[model samples]
Target: MVSAGLYWLLSLAFLWGGFVQMGYPGMAGEVCIAFVICLFLLRFILVKRFVAASVFNVAATVVFFIFIAILQAKGMTGVA
Candidate 1:
């Protein structure tokens, strides 16, 4: 139960981040993709698939950094 709750919180945070990033001109579609990935992460956690959830979480983190790097390379200056 505690683990599930923690995972839920993390997923919500990711969703919130995605929403906040949606206003950036080149980021809307990427944010949507992140939202979907976070949803799946939430589903995996809720279903007690810890292994899959962990794997997804790692993959999501990697993908997120990749996106950030891409944005930086594209000269996106704002943190928003």
Candidate 2:
């Protein structure tokens, strides 16, 4: 529960940062990541499916890396 809360907070922070730096178009990946996190939270809370939640968490991490790769390729990097 605590970890899930922390992940949720981190997702929100990333989404906000993405929106602020690059606007709505750049937030597409963040939105998908956030959706996966929400699903993970729902599965964990309502269904008590730890394994499924873990899978979702892994998927979200993979997606996040892919998003970062895409951003890097585009030279965004969120450095500004």
Candidate 3:
């Protein structure tokens, strides 16, 4: 139950951060993507898939960053 709350909070944080970063020009997607991948690996190895919350957090982070990247690539800097 606590883990689930943490996941939701982290997911929202990531979404907020992604949009904030999106406003700035020349933000590299590679770094964020790498971080997300690492988080996934860590969650899988350490958490052992027993906690579904972590997975949702990671997935939400990844998806939000991807969306930001797509928007940035399309020159939507001001949209954020």
Candidate 4:
């Protein structure tokens, strides 16, 4: 119930962010996909341990930065 709401909200956020990061198509798409993957991974490992949450956070952050790297590689400083 509550998680479903959260997922929709997060999906909206990711869509908006991904649109802004469109300069690097591959990286932006990968990061958005990673966000969704983390959401499911966390759900699959809920409550038994906090490890899944921690890993998701770290992976999401890394993916975001990787997207930035791709943007730079594409020479799209003004895109965002």
Give residue 3's lDDT in candidate 2 (0 to 100).
54
lDDT of each: 0.59, 0.58, 0.56, 0.58
**Tens-digit lDDT track for model 2 on 5-34?**
555665676666655655444555555456
Ranked by lDDT, the better of candidates 3 and 4 is 4
- Predicted structure 3: lDDT: 0.56
Top model number, lDDT: 1
Candidate 4 lDDT over residue span 1-80, tens digit each: 44445445666666676667765645655566566666566657763465555555555555545755775787643434
Q: Model 1 clash tally?
A: 0
**Which 10-residue span in candidate 3 carries the lowest summed lDDT?**
27-36
Give me candidate 1's TM-score against the actual structure. Answer: 0.43
lDDT of 3 at 7: 51
**Looking at model 4, which ten-residue stretch has the lowest summed lDDT?**
1-10
TM-score of each: 0.43, 0.49, 0.37, 0.40
Those runs of model 3 whose alpha carbons end farther than 4 Å from true positions after fitting are 1-51
Tens digit of lDDT per residue, candidate 3, span 1-37?
Answer: 5555655565455545555665456654333445455
Residues 11-65, model 1: lDDT tens digits:
6665676677677767654654466686575655654545565555565555555
- lDDT value for model 1: 0.59
